[model samples]
Target: MTAVKIIKVLGTSAESWEDAANEAVARANDTIDDIRGVEVEDWTAEVENGAVTEYKATVEVAFPVREGNP
Candidate 1:
């Protein structure tokens, strides 16, 4: 049997929501192993003078728990 865990993270980019989601996964990869997938929960934008200055993403990352470890 395998176990899975979910963690929430936030990422921001000046590009787009897709970039922000990618950034979230990339950063999580730095510390997390056995990553299975990511779910983009929400998206928001920061506006500056009626223009989108940044894109923010709320991401849920899923990873498999190591065997023989709790």
Candidate 2:
């Protein structure tokens, strides 16, 4: 049997939601391995002068559980 663990990550982008999600995954991949999937939990955008300035996304990242060395 295999176990999976989930982690929450928040990322910001100046363009779109896709960029935000990609940013989150890129950050998680920096220190983690065997990344399984990503789910967008929430999204928000910042506006300035009646224009969208930034897009933020919260994602749930899942990875396979690793066994500790004995």
Candidate 3:
């Protein structure tokens, strides 16, 4: 049998929500391997002077569970 793990991370970007999510995954890739998928759990943004200053994405990252480890 195969198994996987899921974790949540918040990514922020001055670009766009999609970029925010990409940031999260890219960061996760720094240490974690075998990244299976990503799910955008939520969306948010920061506004300043009536203009959107930043975009935020709450993402769930998934990766496989190795044998003899969790």
Candidate 4:
């Protein structure tokens, strides 16, 4: 049996939602390990003067729980 944990993250990008998701995961990886999965929970965009300026994503990231390290 294995233990898992989930965390929510928000990421933004000038390109697309995919990139935003990737960015969130990448940033998470900087401090986290054993990445298992990611769920894109929401999507949004930033508008500037009636034009879409950026894309944003809300994600749920999952990974195996580690023991006795923290």
lDDT by residue for model 2 over 1-70, one digit each (tens)?
A: 8899999999999999889989999999998898999999999999999998999999999999988962
Clashing pairs in 3: none
Off by over 4 Å in 3: none
Q: Per-residue lDDT tens digits of candidate 4, residues 8-68?
A: 9999999898999899999999988888999999999999999878999999999998878
C-alpha lDDT of residue 17 in model 3? 95
- Per-residue CA lDDT of model 1 for 1-70, tens digit only, reads 7889999999999999999999999999999998998899999999999999999999999999887666
Task: List, residue by residue over 1-70, the lDDT tens digit for candidate 3.
Answer: 7799999989999999999999999999898899999999999999999999999999999999888756
Model 1 clash tally, residue pairs = 0
- lDDT, residue 32, model 4: 83
| Better by TM-score, candidate 4 or 3 | 3
Clash list (residue pairs), candidate 2: none
By how many angstroms RMSD does model 4 differ from the true structure? Answer: 1.2
Model 4: colliding residue pairs: none
